[model samples]
Structures are given as C-alpha cells and as structure tokens.
Target: MKSSLFKISVLIGIFSIVIYACKDKDNNEKLEETVLQGTATIYVDQTLQPIVEDQTAVFESQYNVKLNLVNQSESEVVNALLTDKTQIAVLSRKLTKEEENHFNQKKIIPKITHFASDAIVFITNKASQDTLIDLQEVLNLLQEKESKIKALVFENPNSSIVSYMNNLAGVKNGQKKNIYSLNSHKEVLEYVSNNQGSIGVIGLNLLVQPFEDTKQYTDKIAVMSVRNVKSQPNNVLYYKPNQSNLGEGLYPLKRPIYMLNYQGTAGLGMGFASFVAGDIGQRIILKSGLLPVRIPSRELNIRKEIINNK
Candidate 1:
C-alpha cells in the first residue's frame, strides 16, 4: 500500500509539470503574434510631417502596417535615436562623424535611406518687391551690425534651417538682429503673408501639394531666389524653387534629405524606409517640387521646329 501511494504522488507531480510547460509555450506564441502585428513609432523633423503624413496613409493601405509618427526637431530625433527612444529617424542631413561613432561604439549599424532633395526657399509677401537676393546680401542681412529686415523661420528650438543659413551666408560672426523665429511654418507663412517687409525662409516640402490645394497659399506669398554669388557677383540673377530648377542644380538653397533606421530586421523603420525609397515613394517626392532619389522619367515636349531641324 505504501509503494502504490508513492507512485501515485510522483505521477501527479509529472502531470503538473507538463501542464505548466504547455501554458508557457502558448504564452510565448501569443507574445510573438502580438509583436508581428505591433505598431512602429517614427520620429522625424517637423518640416517633414506633412510629407510623411500623406505618404503614411498610402503605405498603410498597401503594407497593412501602422505607423505611429511623432514630429519634432532634427536634433530631438537624433537624441531619441541615441537613447533608443525610437527605432527610426527621418532628417534633412546625414549623421555627423561623432554621431556615427556613437552608434558604432554600441555596435548599431544604422541603415541610411536617401529619399528626396529639398531646397530652402525664401519668400516675401506677394506685394513685396524683394524678389531676389545675392548670397553676400543674405550674409550681410544675417550678420550686419544693425539690421531691420525681419527674418522669419519655424519654432523648433534646434532647427537645421539656422545652420544651413549660416553655411550659405558664411555667418560665423554671430546671430544677427531682427531674426524673428516663429512657432511653425504655418505661422511663418501667415506672418509673411500679412507683413510685406518680413522675409520667410522654409523648406520646399511645405509648398508641395496639389496645384489646387497650394494655389491659395503660393498666391499670397512669392518665393525669392538666391543668386550664385561666386559666379554672378553683383549680378542679381535669381532662380525660383521649382522641380526643374532643383533637378538642374539651379537652386542654391537645396539640401539632401535622409531617413536613418537604427532598429534593423523586421521593424516599422525598415518598412517605412523601403516604401519611401521605392518607386511610389519617389513619385510622391516628385510631386512636391523636390528631387526624388530614384529619378523619374520625363516626357520631353520637343517643339515642331526643333524636331523638324533634327
């Protein structure tokens, strides 16, 4: 009777162990399924919000993946990537050597995807006569001892606009007077639209939209052109910011835009990056008066005279 009782006790213990193992396996499978359907958070420069917002809707429809996007300054995005706060970051410029080294030290190989090229455009009220400015004039405007010209920009605390301006103007001196950095591009547009004397500088992505959607805004403000100072010194020949101009390298204010993915393999970052660099992604960029990384084919309209001569 004692031997039979011991066997029963041991069998019961083994049965309980098997049940617990089965439950643990089921729980792990459920967790993995959740991860496969999970959402991805993408942190990007504020200026690229509108561009991405539109692209996200289309990407979701095709990929069945959701993008949880957060808009902030480029600097903020960089900081988040360093802290593992985000998996992907879209920015106007590539990472610096120091930043690259930081990731390398951590054994994180960031995937860089170049999607579009945008030009920083300067605009004044439609009624204002200041249509063109030389690089020297812009430098003086930003660095002059006493200046009254109000230069407007977005509200982000750390913006690439300021740095890009400094590079173009060679303004190593210091902050100039009358630089009224505003809260957002919308506010900058409104302020410049209302005030004729004020000049607004912004990314070209802000102006990209369907012709009907953007006509009202573009009509209110006229974009100014920056001349090639070294090539055309004292001559104020200005080239407007347009898709053709950007492609031809006529826009002096143009800058390359990139998307950096720190989280590798099967993450939301890779999904979005793939979409933006693909054919569809590039088409969207082309619509915005910016140059896409993947060049699109253009239909050349040859005039009858030229065609006949050839």
Candidate 2:
C-alpha cells in the first residue's frame, strides 16, 4: 500500500509539470503572433515621391508589413488623415493648428516626427549665366509683373508650394506673370533641361545622387546657388547641394522633412515612426546627401599591423 501511494504521488507530480510546460509554450506562441501586420496607406506629397518610394521598399523588406502608398499633395495628405482615409502621411511639413484641432476633437493627438532633411533646389540650364541669386532677387523676379523671366513650379494645385511662392514674393495683389506650374517634377526637369532660359524649382532629392557611370540629372541641367543672406550682395554662397553644405547650413533652401501620424501606438505607423528615429534609419538619410536629424559619428580604427601590411 505504501509503495502504491508513492507511485501515485510521483505520477501526479509528473502530470502537473507537463501541464505547466504546455501552458508556457502556448503563451510564447501567442506572444510571437503579435507582429505588425496589416494594410496601411502612406499618403505622400508629390515632392517626396521619388525618395519615399525607395525608402518605403527598404522599410517594407526590413519590417514584415505591407505599405500601400498614395501619391498626393501635402494638403491632400493632411485632409486624407482627417477623413480617416490613411493612417500615415509623409510630407515636407507637419499639420497646421486647424488640422491638429481635428485630431484633438476626436480625442487623438497626432504624432509628428522629423525623419530627414531636404532642400528646395533651384536649377537652370547650363547656358544661363544667372547662377546665383538671393531670395529677395527670386522674390522680385517671381513677383515682378513686367519681368520676362518665367518661373516653373511642380504643380499649380499644390497649395503649400503655391503658398511658399506667395510668401516669398509677397504677392498680395495676384499671381505673377512668370510664375507657372507643370504637371510633375519630371516634367519640370525635362522642360528646364531642354530649355536654356527656364528655371526649375524642385525638391533636391530627385537629382542628388547621380545614375550609372555619370551624373544623370546634372548632365541635362546645372544647379544654381542662392546668394548669402548676410554678405554684401550675398556674393559668398554654397553653389551645389551636398551633405556637407546641407549639414553645415550653407544650403539656403533647406527644409525640415516630416512624417505625421494621426495616432501614436496602434499600427505599423508606430513601427515606422520608431525606426525613422533610430540610428540605422538616420544613417540612410545621411547616405542620401541629406542631413539626418540625429547625427551619428563613425569611428574607424586602423591598427599599426594593418598599416604595415602592404
């Protein structure tokens, strides 16, 4: 009887251990299932299309998520977020106060994160001698009713771009004679590349890095410089757009690039938001000739043995 009781107790102990192990295993599997999975639309501005398309692909591959991107203007993207059309938005600027109010009314505070930096580049044909001009000069030329020089923008429907022009030119009366808009940035580039007299105002990311074996974009066009705002006649200036110039604040047209989210912690949007603020992500921005908001310093150590090696 004693032997039988001991056997029964041992059996009960083994059974309890097995049940506990099974429960723990099940819990782990459940935790692993909680991954960022879903379909989300990233409404983007036309200005960021060229750059965002590449970044989105890389991000999707890194994080197992599907991003449905819709190309639109900044204002359009903001409107889409307010209307519950998209969960994420990538644009040049953040939401205005009125847009913020929409989120607040819904008891949600939108998240705004600065990912990378960009510049509004001015490009002119190689034949044009007018390579350097101040913002005042640009304003004067764009606002002058009698000026013969024509200015081309990305799109007429782009209110943000239009507003920038209006603010810079101080156009209270009406639209200027020379200021016009094109269908797309590619169209603007092609038009200005072929026409020696035209000046093309476009986002810098499109033409920053060159293509196979040569400077693809620069072959067709020459980038102009904005004169220094402080110097006399603004003679001293940075001509070409590069990481150094942009990082050092020599680039006059630099703008803070942003990604806005209507909600903070519910979707793949948060994942992307966190990644953009990470070091590896910021490095991608640095590699693109654009300044990263969080700069990282790389330390290289060359040993004496390696130096003596060849």
Candidate 3:
C-alpha cells in the first residue's frame, strides 16, 4: 500500500506541473508590456506636465498598468529616447531626421502622434502695465539688440522654451545679457512677480490650467498678449494663447505636442498613444485649456417622446 501511494503521488505531481505550464502564457509573461495590462515608463517634457498628469491619472485609474512618468527638460527627454534609456517620450517638438535615423538603424520605427497644440507664453508681474509684447522685440532682445524689456526670465536653460525662442530668434550662441533662467516655471513666475520690469517666458499650459503648485502664482502674474512685427503695424493684432487662437492658427508662438513610441510591438506605449489620440483623450485635452488634435464631437440624443420615470 505504501508503494502504491508513492506512485499515485508522483503521477499527481506530474499532472500539476503540466497544468501550471499550460495556464495563460500571455498573462504569465510579466516582463513584456501589453496594451491594457503591463508596465511602462514615459519621459515627458516638464512644460507639458500639467495636461499629461491629468491624462496619466485617468489612464492609470482605468487600466491595470503603472506608468512611470519622468518629467524633465525637453533635451533630457530626447536624450533618453535616443540612448535607449526609454522607448517612449512626450515632447514639444518632433524628432529630427538624424535622430529618427538612429532608431531606424536599430530596426525600430518611430510612431509619432501629434496629440495637441501648445504655445510659448509671455507673462509679467500683475502690477506691471506691460500687457502686450511684440514678438519681434522679444526676438531682438534674444539677439542682444535694443529692446524695451529690461530683463527676461525663463525656466530651465535646457527646457523647450529656450530652444524654441533660440530658434525663433536665430541665436546660435546663447541668450546671455538680459536673459536669466530659474530652476522651474514656478520660480520664473515668482521671480517675475517680484521683479519690476521683468518678463517671464513659459509654456501656455502652466499659465492656463495651473497645477496646485502654480495656483498661487497664477493670480500674481499677468499673461501678455503677443503681436507679430511682421504683420502690418497699423493692423497688427495682439493675440493671447487661447483655444480660438490655437484652433484658427492665429497664435504665432504655437507648437505641436508629439508622443513618440518605439516599443516596436503592441506595448503599453502603443496603448497610451492610442488612448491620448482617441476621442476620450482628445476630450481631456480640450477641457485642459489646450487644443486637441481633433475636436471631440458632441452627441445630441433626440427622442420622439419623453417619459418621466420619476
């Protein structure tokens, strides 16, 4: 009877091994990131943090995945993507041809999704009388030419705002002289609010839908409307960064927001890209005081008759 029991136990153990081996191979692979259930790490440009945070919170609540969001400067975000530190990034600009080639050489095709529209914003102390800024004058100041502005404050030197303004001003060297940079956008706001005759350049999202950290500074700083000098002087219009201006392409400082995915498979990046570019994600953008890629359609349900259940 002891020998019979031993043989029976061995057979049962073998059966259990087979059952475990056959069980849900798809769910068992924890290393791979899937569409709805897995892990992912995304690097986001700090300027776009507010809106991305809203999307991330909603995405995490609805899905069974954890997204490690690293908000840093635009250059850092791009470097992380090129060096393969990460396969996904949210940027204020697109990858250059050379940058794209680096990934292509590794047999990874980049999938870029233009999700929303954002712009560079100019702000000043609330007590200041300068409510309008000429884009040309700002560019002139960047080039070290004569300008009305006393000092210009900006976020991190490595941030996208610096790159965008440098490119626009055609300044290859550096914005030294009257230009200064703080550690963060909120610091710039605080500096501008305290300093007289100083202007702060930041992303529009920070000024529009401010996070809790920036809420206190929102009321202290005044957003300046920008006018393009290239337009006829008499008919020039100073336009603020707003939904109407962004949608109609009247905002001169506007830039496109992109999400580049190089996961090379149906990974969590693909899932997030689809989610942000989809109807629901676009709606989130629309409500965040940013311009969505495609406007979310409004549904009107009309019934032939109405019934009062109550």
The 0-to-1 C-alpha lDDT of every candidate, in the order given, reads 0.74, 0.71, 0.88
TM-score of each: 0.77, 0.78, 0.87
RMSD of each: 9.6, 9.6, 5.3
| TM-score rank order | 3, 2, 1
TM-score-best of 1 and 2: 2
lDDT of 3 by residue, 1-310 (tens): 9999999999999999888887756557665568877888999999998888889899999999899999999989999998889999999888988889988898987788999999999988899887998888888889899988777888999999999999898887464899998899989987887876678999998888777887888788888998966678696689989999988877789999999898898889989989999998999999999999999999999999999999
Say which candidate scores most in TM-score. 3
Q: Candidate 1, residues 175-207: lDDT per residue as tens digits?
A: 456566776677777777788867788778876
Of 1 and 3, the candidate ahead on lDDT is 3
> Which candidate, 1 or 2, has the higher lDDT?
1
Candidate 1 ranges with C-alpha deviation above 4 Å: 1-38, 145-157, 170-175, 210-218, 234-236, 297-310
* lDDT for position 192 in model 3: 80
Model 2 clash pairs are none
Error of 2 at 288 (Å): 1.5
- Residue 262, candidate 3: Cα error in Å is 1.3
TM-score of 3: 0.87
